[model samples]
Target chain A: MRDAFHDELNALNDRLMQMTNLVRSAISRATTALLDADLQLAESVISQDAEVNRLYAEIETSIYELMATQQPVAVDLRTAITALRMGADLERMGDLAEHVAKIARMRHPVSAIPVEVRDTIVEMGQIAERLVTKTGSCIATRDVDLAKELEDDDDAMDRLHRRLFRVLLSKDWPHGIEPAVDITLIGRYYERYADHAVRVARDVVYLVTGSREFDDSAS
Target chain B: MRDAFHDELNALNDRLMQMTNLVRSAISRATTALLDADLQLAESVISQDAEVNRLYAEIETSIYELMATQQPVAVDLRTAITALRMGADLERMGDLAEHVAKIARMRHPVSAIPVEVRDTIVEMGQIAERLVTKTGSCIATRDVDLAKELEDDDDAMDRLHRRLFRVLLSKDWPHGIEPAVDITLIGRYYERYADHAVRVARDVVYLVTGSREFDDSAS
Candidate 1:
């Protein structure tokens, strides 16, 4: 029974990793589509979202079954629960990618946003992808150190987001208010993507250390 | 044993409700602080955040104790897990309120943000407060219908967000990019607050229905 449980758990992790890869690619393509005005690429991101959604549904069902049948205890329970949360994060990332794609379709061509802003957003997207990749590794290997590194990487993304806004609010901002607003929203999406990645990293840390490190505040 | 287990679960729910009420007040006060640019009110929101954080830490510790001691199965485990998730959401809502307080400090005594825009944000804040309040009631009573209603309320907030963006992006946008960015980020904070409330509601739905109404792909 223990061996069977391990095998099933591995299978579940494999599915989560696959979903993570899809989310990462969707984000990448969506960013590229936004920069290049590739409506086809944007549409593809939109189309692929259903797959991510379907995978999440399947993963949730599998998780529920695993919990019911295997009755995971202690660390195994944490692992399963973390995967469930990670699945949710990945699915939401997919949704953000879809939103980016939809925006790309809406704007199309010459782009209301400036190239410099788009470049910064693309850079933020790369950072978000790295965060997701590190998080996936942390889960698959149960590496607490790798997860901690993702947390630090999130700081970098946060800095980029601040910089993005600074640029949006600069006097020389060329594309006017619409583009500034668009880029700022895009920056927020990237920032939120990184935030969710850090959340998954925190869960991974908790899974391995059995200690959650969130900051405490008084009510 | 079962009776004691149920009692403890109820206690946990009661504490979560308390945290929800605290978060609701934080948002409301944060809104007042923003509208009035009252340093006293902003300081209050900032000071009150520690309380929310402490409550979250306490609840998390209590949850760990319950899991370690009770070894709850199935639905009971789900309840503990949902509590953990909801605690995180409330903590985030508090953080967002604090963010608004910071905004108040940065743009005090007369925000460049237009009166109309400020009113729209205040409305969004009110909606977020209602979402949390309804969420508290739904979780305490396990009212799935009330949970669904909160989901509908999120849809209304989304509409408000879109309208806010439309006005900011219109040809006659007067406050320039800085105020527009401020408005967008604040809208995002409220939107995310609503999103987490919907997440808590979905958890309630899952707890009661054994099937999730909203997954990660949900808006």
Candidate 2:
């Protein structure tokens, strides 16, 4: 029974890694879709979110089942509960990706991002992608130090987010309200995507350390 | 043992109700702060969010303890896990409210919502308050029908959100980019607050019906 439970735990970890990959792809493609004005890629990213959600549900159900059946205690119980929260975080990251894709699809044939701020959005996307990739490894290894490192990585994204705001609020921002709003939301999407990845890493940290000091505000 | 577990579950429910009240008050007061330019009220709302987070952490820890010790199955297991998710939803709702308050405080001595769109924001806040109130009750009673009704309440919010966008996009938007951006984010805070309320209510629906049909994209 112990071995079986360990097997199930391993399976849960594998599924979480799969989810991380899916979310990374979604954000990467969605960024391309937003930058290139590629409707086909946007549509694909939007459609693929269902798969992410499916995996989320699978992981969630499995976590609950593991808890109910195995009654894991101590570190094992923490691991199970953290997986549940991480699944939700990953699922939300996927939704943020979808929102980005929807924005791309909404402005088809025309990029959602203005050329002036395109570079910042591109960099934000790259940072988001890198953060999620690091988060996947952190979860896989249960490395608390790596998990803590994600917070610093998230700082870069937050800095970029603030810079986007500065550009928007600047007098030279030639983009009118429409594009400004779009860019504002798009920047938010990337910023929040990184936030969620950081959140997942934080949960991994809590799972390892049994501490809540790293909890960021809320969700 | 079973009775003790049920008692713990009831306590969890009570805590969740308390969280809903805190979140509702936060949004309501934050709206007033935004509309009235009430810096004191905004500060109060922002500071009080710590209490909401405290309750969230308390409830979360309790749920994990219950699950690990009791190892509830079937409906019991579902109830525990759902409570955990609902706690997160409520906590996030509080954070959204706090964000609104911070915005109000940041622009203090001046209202965040311009006079042109003030009424719309006021209505959105009212809808958010009503939705959370109903959500609290639905959670208390596990009323699936009432839970379904929240989606409609959220629809009203969505419509208002879109209307705000139309006004922003309209040729008659006299407010410049700063106020436009402020209004946009404020609208989103309320809209997302409502979305979390709907999510909690939907979780109640799922708890009672054992259905995942109403999973709203992601948490």
Candidate 3:
């Protein structure tokens, strides 16, 4: 029974890592689609999110079954619970990627990102990809140090998010209200995507340490 | 043992209801702050979010203790898991409300909402309040029917969210990029809040029936 429960936990970890990979690819493609107005890439991101959701649904079912059958306690219990949360955050990361793709699709034949903000969007996308990559590593390795590093990536994403806004709110922002609205929502999507990645990493930390990061700080 | 587990579940439900009320008030005051440019009200919303967070942290601790010590199975298990998920959604709702309040605070003495889009925001805020109110009741009563009704409120919120974008995109929109950006984000915050409420409702349904709504649809 113990070995079987451990196997189930390993399977849950593998599923969560798969989710991270999919979300990473989704955001990477979403950024390209936005920058180049590649409707095909955008469409692919939007459509392929179903696979991410399918994985998430599978993870949910498996976790429920594992808890129902195994009744894991202590560290194993934390593993199951945090896996559920990590799956949720990764699932949301997928949605955020799709949201970015939808914006690209919406403005097909014309790039949604203004030329001035192009570099920032590129950087945000890279940060998002980087964060998710590290998140996957943390999940797979249970490396607490790597999980802590995710906060730095998150901070960098926030900096770029603010920069995107500054460009929008600049006096010479020539794109007017339409692009402003698009950029505002797009920037928010990337920032939120980064946030979910960080959250998943935090769960990894919690699962490994058996202590929530915030609680550690408070104590 | 079963009676004690159920007692803990009941306490979790009561905490969730309390969270719902806190978030509902937060959104209500956030809307009023944005519309009236009421600095005091926005400040209150911003500051009071800590209380919501406190309650959520308490609930998390309780749920973790419940799961760890009891290893509840079946319906008791679902209730504990869903309580954690619902607590998370409600905590996010609190953050969304605080986002609105921060916008209000930023634009103090000058309304962040333009006169043209004011009605839509008012309606959005009202729907948010109503959805969360139903969410509270759904958690309290585990009423699947009441939980289903939240989808209608969510639809109403979606309609208003689009209406907000329409007014912003219209050719005659007098506001420039700043207010437009604010409105776009505020609209999204409210829309996402409603989505979270619907999710909580869905969780309520799942806890009651031991079946996911989407699973039922798929079958």
Candidate 4:
């Protein structure tokens, strides 16, 4: 019985890592779709988010069942519960990626980058990919040190997010309100994506330390 | 043992309701601060968010303790875990309110909202409050009917959200890019607040029904 419970726990860990990989691909494709105006890639990201959601649904069901039947306690209990949160965070990351894709779809054949802020979007996208990739490693390995380092990546994302605003708010901005609005929303999506990744990393820390260190005003 | 576990559950329920009320007020004051450029109200909302966070922490601690010691099963287990999720949703609603308040503070002595979109914001704020109030009731009463009704309010919020975009994108929009960005983010904060409120209600539904109805593309 104990072996079966540990096996279920290991299975849960595998599924979460799989989800991390999916969302990683998601943000990666989403950024490309936005920068290149690739409708097909955007469509792929948008439609494939259901796969991420389906994985989360399975994780939740497994956790619920594990708790109901096996009644895991202590470290095993913490691991099971934290997986549920990490899954939700990853699921939200998927949604944020899809949101970026929808923006790409909305501006199809007409890139939303606007050149002045294109580099910032590119860097933000890269940082988002890096953060989620590390987050997956942290979850699978339970590396608290790796999890702690996500804040630095998050800080980089924040810098780009602010730079995005600076570019938009500049007097020389000639894209008018439409692109500014698109960029604002887009910038928010990337920043939120980064935050959720950090949150998943944070959950890994919580799983290890049994304490949740909530960030101050992630928005 | 079961009775003590249930007593703990009841305490958790009360704390969640209290959190809902705090977030309800947070959104209310945040809206007033944004509309009226009342820095004091905005500051109040901003500072008081810590209270919401503290409450969430306490609830989390209690839930973790209950789970470790009690090992609740079946419905009792479901109630304990669901409380954790509902607490998280309410905590996020508090943060969303603070984001709105920060926007107000950033534009202090100068309203972030323009005259044209002012009414829309007012209505959005009112609906945010209504959604949260009903969310609190849903937590307390477990009334699935009231839980279902939050969808209509959410739909109304989504409609107003679209209306906001229309006004921002309108050719007659005179506010330029800065206010448009502010309005875009503020609209998103309200929309997300409504979404989170709906999620809490959905958790209530899940509590009673044991199945999660994942919404399609809330953003």
Pitting candidate 3 against candidate 4, the one with the higher DockQ is 4
How well is each residue in B100-170 modelled by candidate 4, as lDDT tens digits? 99999999999999999999999999999999999999988999999999999999999999999999999
Tell me the tens digit of each residue's lDDT in model 4 across A143-200.
Answer: 9999989999999999999999999999999889999999999999999999999998
Local error of candidate 4 at residue B215 (angstroms):
5.1
Clash pairs detected, candidate 3: none
- Against the true structure, candidate 4 reaches a TM-score of 0.98
Residue-wise C-alpha lDDT for candidate 1, range A95-184, written one tens digit per residue: 888888887888897553576676677778789889888877877888887877886788888888888887877788777777777777
**Candidate 1 chain A weakest lDDT stretch, 10 residues:** A210-219
Clashes of each: 8, 0, 0, 0
lDDT at B127 for candidate 4? Answer: 98
Error of 4 at A11 (Å): 0.7
Reference contacts recovered by each candidate, as fractions?
A: 0.50, 0.48, 0.81, 0.93
Candidates, DockQ: 0.48, 0.60, 0.61, 0.87
Q: Give a tens-digit lDDT track for model 3, residues A2-80.
A: 9999988888888988999999999999999999999999999999999999999999999999999999888888889
Query: What residue runs in model 2 are displaced by over 4 Å at the alpha carbon?
Result: none
- Candidate 2 colliding pairs: none
* Full ranking by TM-score: 4, 3, 2, 1
Residue A88 of model 4, lDDT score: 92
* Candidate maximizing TM-score: 4
Q: Please give, as one word, the docking class of candidate 3.
A: medium
lDDT of each: 0.80, 0.89, 0.90, 0.93
lDDT of 1 by residue, B39-107 (tens): 888889988988888888888778766766666778887788778878877888889888888777778
- Clashing residue pairs for model 4: none
